[model samples]
Target chain A: MREITYREALREALFEEMRRDDRVFLMGEEVGHYDGAYKVSQGLLAEFGERRVIDTPIAEAGFAGIGIGAAMTGLRPIVEFMSWNFSFVAFDQIISNASKTYSMSGGKIKVPIVFRGPNGAAAQVAAQHSHTVEAFYAHIPGLWVANPSTPRDAKGLLKAAIRMDDPVVFLEGETLYNLKGEVPDASEDEIIPFGKARIAREGKDCTLIAWGAPFHTALAVADRLAKEAGIECDVIDPRTLRPIDETAILESVAKTNRCVIVHETWPYGGPGAEMVDLIQREAFDYLDAPVLRVGSLDVPMPYAKNLESLVLPTPERIETAIRRVTYREER
Target chain B: MSEVKVERWLDDYREMLLIRRFEEESARAYAQGKIGGFLHLYIGQESIAVAAATTIEKGDLVFQTYRDHGTALALGMTPEAAMAELFGKDTGCSRGLGGSMHYFDVENGFYGGWGIVGGHLALAAGAAFRSKYLGEDQVTLCFFGEGATNIGGFHEAMSLAGLWKLPAVFICENNQYAMGTPLSRTSPLSDLSVKAAGYGMVGDRFEGYDVDVVREHLKKAIDRARSGEGPSFLEIETYRFRGHSMSDPGKYRTAEELEERKKKDPILLILGKLRDAGVDEAKIEAIEDEVEERIEAALKHADEAPFPEESLLYETVTVEKF
Candidate 1:
């Protein structure tokens, strides 16, 4: 198996999807000639031409809505939000129109549209560009929220998302793009459906559930915790946020009797709340101690590196959460 | 200069009658607590829909605002389905799921009766962009009222539609008021057509009541768009005969102003033209009778239509069950 970057896997998925379906095309602010703001769509315009690799004129709301409308009329469109923080301008279309079309049309129309882009904070982009919205979009009933932590999952889940009959919000993390991982060649029978979480690392002492960038932070702390205290942490990446991998979470919690959820969104009303609530309900019998969630501080993400460090979930915060869950006595 | 024959004029007259009678029906129903939710009507300014639909190319896409009965009727959506949609019946265009303003018939390329004021304008532009991208010789005709001109997406969409040279025709049914807020109260320029030039797109205002004027300019814009020219924004100045919806009291605009607009009533003018064009009195009567019969059948279809079950509401929102 050859190794590929997160960006390359996404590109491969788009290329394959576009080639497979004549109706599938790519549209975004810089998806065509500029090779994308992140270069995920690099070299796409050269091969597919302007027809498939489209360059939009900085109109996010327009392009996104068009993608929904087009998807309704039998064309599959993959629209990039540049950075998902920019999705604010197009949120109405995604929430009101794209998500509602199928049910509103009584199944006569299906919006097979994919709104993809890098999500969550990327270093010090500040408040407007740093907020994570997986929690917000996941709260809605009519969308499939998929965020891939590996190149393999990105490729497989993206292909699955493109071919799916509903609207999927495919959020890619900035920190994971350059992270290399082996990808199995795509096959007809091989597909990763939504709501299926992946166990990145299997362990026994404490269950660590996270997604996107924070998953890496949790892994780093897990390694440290394992080496120092002989405490094994089972790392679970909830591939899809809405359906979450509740089964995986419950099973891990049942075995370990300890749960630590990590995320970059604000701790108050973030995705952590649902995880905390669910574990408290379904996995309460399995709990040895209270489930702790390590997340961004309940305030706007700051610009300064020091302040930013204080705001977001870090290895230290994750380690603390795990230690708390495990009753390590060190905390 | 009204050159439309009696037969064609009668056709549009019937359409106007349908719009009026349907609103009257909706108003009565809403008063009796049958039709629930926001029910915007198109009682007076129907000539805009009829004119624009008749003016554009055969395969052109029509996108409209929440006040969309006229737009649907113009696109030849049967009055029965339109009426039943108001009644929230399973036989409606959207099967009672999209009650009132959220009408959609994608097969006919009727993009919406979108509830969001400025939101669908961009969607229509994107459709037009795709049309040009795929080498399809078609235009996306977006219809919004004057109220939408202030929205953020409207500015962005108009600008993009201009810069990309996309084949989109922006039709603004400027009916003097945005809900309760009059044009004079909201817009400083008051003429939104002039705002099109700011976006580097051509914009013009027209007398919406004069169907001939609307048709002539619409054909010109449609031709310009289909032939690879950029988009054009039409500020079709018309008047809404009813309140914003079925329940409006008609208190915002004066009766004198309403009387003045009545002088420009397109359906009556079309009937007058049909008489002057040497059309037979018997043929005119026959066409009116046919429209009446069609409306009657449509209402009958609606009355007998069923409501969608609650179990059906949970389905189709997403591909997989949570």
Candidate 2:
């Protein structure tokens, strides 16, 4: 196994996929000559040439529609928004066209395209720049939504998203792009299918369910609880939100008799709310206490560092919620 | 007259008549509540679709707005499929998943009848881009109301098409009103073709009531695009005789104006041209009879067709239905 940054892992996936499939091309703002805003597509243009690594204008709706059209006409396009926040400009294209084309065309057409970009708070970037809209996208029927937390999952899930014969919204954590982790030295064809959860840490006292960058907070809280508070917990990371890994979460919850779902998205009408509903329905009888959730404060992320920190979920908050769910009193 | 000219003229006349009759029947069906949802009849603008479809090659693609029954009928979609789609039956072109506002048939190169006013322009540009990117000799034509020209997507899509040299033609049907708002009040420029210069593309305007005139203009534009000369914009002047949708009373214009436009009705205009060309009146009557029966059979088939199974509702919603 080799340790690489999540950004590097994503770049490798794009490079490998483009090499393997000529139909696959990366198109968006700064993807070609500029090598991407965050350089996730660095060296792609030079390696794949300008034709394959395209640079599009700053028209989100236009380019998003172009990606959908290209997908309809037998080319696989990876349309990159500068950030998930910018995707709102193209929401009509994503929701009305990309997500509905398959059914609208009587199953004769498939929009095999991926709309990917950095999502959530990248660091003090403020209100307009920070958004975790995976749940909003997953709410649509014809789309596949995935949010990968680690470098390995990023590469694997991205490869899978590109290969699937459907439209996919690939939400990458901006903060986790630079974070380093051990990735398996596997073949390029290897992929982690959607609707599967990875157990980040195994224990029995309680289960902490999370995804994307927030999974790190869950892992940290679980580690601290075990070492300092004598509480062991299982941390589950649901990589895909649409076809969610409910069985894994329910199994973990049933075994632990406790649950605390953590996410960086808004608490109201967010992914956590849907997860809570599902858990209560399927794993209701096994619960020892009411399932709790640790989510960001329901406000737009502020520009100031302190305010942004307060808006996002913290490990301490996750630990506190976990303790409450586990019925353990703090020292 | 050349044999080919007579044959082409007859084909265009038949197409225009079929669209006119199909729309008339659709109106009747909607009145009877056989068809549901918003129904936009392409009653007056039959020539534009007939001419465009006649000019475009088999491999050429078409993207249209919600008033798309005429366009789909002109593009060789079976009358049965179109009627079935309007009836929301399983045998429809979109298998009942898409009704009038969302008619689609990818295999026929008919992309969709998009509901949003101006949204499909970018999608059409992208389709053209794919054609160019893959070195395919395919041209894409996007048909939208003149009101759509005011939207940001129209500008973005047009600019991208020009900048990329995509093989596309954007046709704006300036049919007097966009759901009751006059074209004059909708955009600043009266001649919508002038907006094409902003995107650095060739611009042209046409009288949409005459099938021959529309076919000549559209043929020239399609040829230019097919030759890799980039996209073109055409603003066709026309009028919608009926209300915007099925429910519209169409009180925006006076009766005199409607009568004046009807004098140049596309189907009557072409039928007169056929008679002047010495095409037999008996042949014309026979064609009309055949078209009437086709429409009748299509309606009957759609009426008898079953609705989609309950499982199909969930099946077509996503690709991974299995």
Candidate 3:
């Protein structure tokens, strides 16, 4: 095992997958020559050359649809959106063309493409640049939505997303790129399967479920609750949102008898709402308290530093939900 | 007349007539409540599809808009499969999932029956990108209506196709109206091919009334693409005799205008050419009789075909369910 940055881990996945399969190519703005907006595609252009590591104009819809078309004809394209916020421009292509092509063509078309980029708020990028698009993409049927929270998950899940014979929306945390964590050696080739939740920290008193940037916050809050109030929490990170590890969440809720979901997406009609519904419906009898959720405020992300910080789910906000679900008094 | 000329003329005539008969039967099926959803007929514009079929090779790919039955048939999709798809049956090209707007037959290199006007253009470019990337000599033919030329997807796809030098031929079948909005009202220029200059691509415009003329133009574009000369924008001027869909009465145009346009019907134009080529009257009648029988068989097959099993509903959503 080697400690590596999440960005490095993702790059390794691309490098490995591209080497393994010639059909796999990386195409996006600044991916080549500029080495990617976030540098996740650094060194790829030099190693893979211009043909494999392509750079395109700032046309998301064009490249996205092109990626879908390429996938349909037998090339695995990794289309990078500089940020998930920009995917809206290509929403019709991703939703209508990529997602439905398989079923619409009666399984004759397979869009083995990966649309990946930094997702959710990064610094004070504000409304237009900051969008947590997992809920919107996950709601679609023919897509696999993977939001990896750790370096290991980043490398493994990305490898799996690239290899899968379906369209995948790979959401990387904007702030988590530089976060260091242990990743399996290259020879090991660890590929994490989707629809499996990782129990970051296990306990029985309460369950705190989160993903992406919010997963790190949940871990910190869980540590704090255990140290200060002895309120042990089972921290769970659902890396994939679409096929979602319902069993893991239900079993954790059944054991803990309480649940609290935290995420950077908006509260209204978010993946958190879906999780709440799933928990209440499947593990209703086991619950000692109603499953609560701590999500970003339902308003558009604000530009001001203070308001922006308050808009996203913070550690304090997550802890409050945890305490409420476990019936612990706020400190 | 040379045998080759007669053979090509006869093949073109039969193909166009087959499409016409298929579309007419589809309209009847829709009226009888056998085919649900929208049914877009390719009546007056058979020359473009027939020309496309004549130009491309086996590996060449064809993409089309919602009004795709003609292109599907021209690309070798059996009438039974196309009719069954419209009828929403298991025997359909897309196994009853795609319906009228999504008749897909990948085996024939017919990529789709895309419903979105301009959305499939990018995908078409992408397919061409794959060909160029792999050094494969396959050309991609993207057929879209004039309405699609105005959308963001159209510009984006065109820009990429030009920038990448992809082997794609963007065929804009400007059949006057985009679902009843005439090109005069929608497009800034009457010659939609002029849009290609903005993207640094070559432009060609021609009347789509004669299959031979349309095929010759299409062949030049497809040959250029195959030779790695990049994409070309072809604005094929044509007309749709039927409404945009089954629901449209085409009340926007006057009876006189419709009648005037009908006089230049592609089928009639080709029929006249066939007669001038000394093709026998009995031979033409036999082809018509054969097309009628095929259309009748397609209708009967579609009528008897079963709806898809409920389990198929969950199957095709994703290739491998997780």
| Candidate that scores best on TM-score | 3
Ordered from best to worst TM-score, the candidate numbers read 3, 2, 1
Candidate 3, A23-132: lDDT as tens digits: 99999999999999999999999999999999999899999999999999999999999999999999999999999999998878899999999999998988898889
Q: lDDT at B106 for candidate 3?
A: 88
Clashes of 1: 1
- Please write out the lDDT profile of model 2 over residues A1-331, one tens digit for every residue: 7899999999988988999899999999998888899999999988989788889889999989888888988899999998999999999999999998888877877889999999888877788888888769988888989999999999999999898889999999988989998787657466889889999899999988898888897898899889988899988999999889888999999899898899989889888999999999999999999988888898888898888887889977887898888778687
TM-score of chain A of 2: 0.98
Give me the runs in candidate 3 sitting further than 4 Å from their true place.
none
lDDT, model 2, position A2:
88
Ranking by DockQ: 3, 2, 1
By lDDT, the better pick of 1 and 2 is: 2
lDDT of 2 by residue, B138-252 (tens): 9999999988988888988998889898999999998979889997778788888998899989999978999889988999999999999999999999988899998899998
Query: How many clashes in each structure?
Result: 1, 0, 0
Ranking by lDDT: 3, 2, 1
Docking class of 1: medium
Q: Among these predicted structures, which one has the highest DockQ?
A: 3
